[model samples]
Target: MQTIDMTEFQSIDLRIGTIVRAEDFAKTKKPAYKIWVDLGDLGIKKSSAQITFHYRPEELIGKQVLCVCNFAPKQIADFMSEVLVTGFSDIEGHIVLATGDKPIPNGAKLH
Candidate 1:
């Protein structure tokens, strides 16, 4: 695996946000969801995440999640994804969302 310096990791804008809206990304070739997260001062940002294996649209709403907010927007199908929702693969290879242990203010940067 490649390694990056602490500075590089710190440069990534990893922040906590609350999922305000979620819906199926029907236009995507793979099953996915288009989520809108409310990032406090940052406002709402959209993301396209392929997490259908473990998450449902209704279950995602109001959930707090971690996101990498500084990346450039990506175009998937007809939607433009604004942030990268961070997650890890479970033992079964399903995507498990990255989140804080407790509730925190939105837009709180991960230190």
Candidate 2:
């Protein structure tokens, strides 16, 4: 299997962020959501997530989730995705977000 060294893994800026906002992504070809996460000192960053199967906008608010903070901005349709909201797929192929069990401060680095 392909594996990255500690340095390479550390290079990925993964942090905890709270979902401040979420909504349906109507302009996209596939079903998705436009999510804005509050990353504390880093401020709020937006992302496009194909996680509609298991998540809804109202339910996502205040939810603390993991994020990849340093990726280059990507434009999906009309949205400029600023961060990657990390998650794993479920048994039925729906996304289950990567989140901490306990509420943690925003922008906390994931070690």
Backbone steric clashes in candidate 2, count? 0
Per-residue lDDT for 1-111 in model 1, tens only? 999999999999999999999999999988999999999999999999999999999999989999999999999999999999999999998899998889999999999
Candidate 2 stretches greater than 4 Å from native: none
Compared with the true structure, what per-residue lDDT tens digits does model 2 show for residues 32-64? 999999999999999999999989999999999
Among all windows of 10 consecutive residues in model 1, the one with the lowest summed lDDT is 92-101
The Cα local distance difference test for each model comes to 0.96, 0.97
lDDT of 1: 0.96
TM-scores for candidates 1 onward, in order: 0.96, 0.97
Number of backbone collisions per candidate = 0, 0
TM-score of 2: 0.97
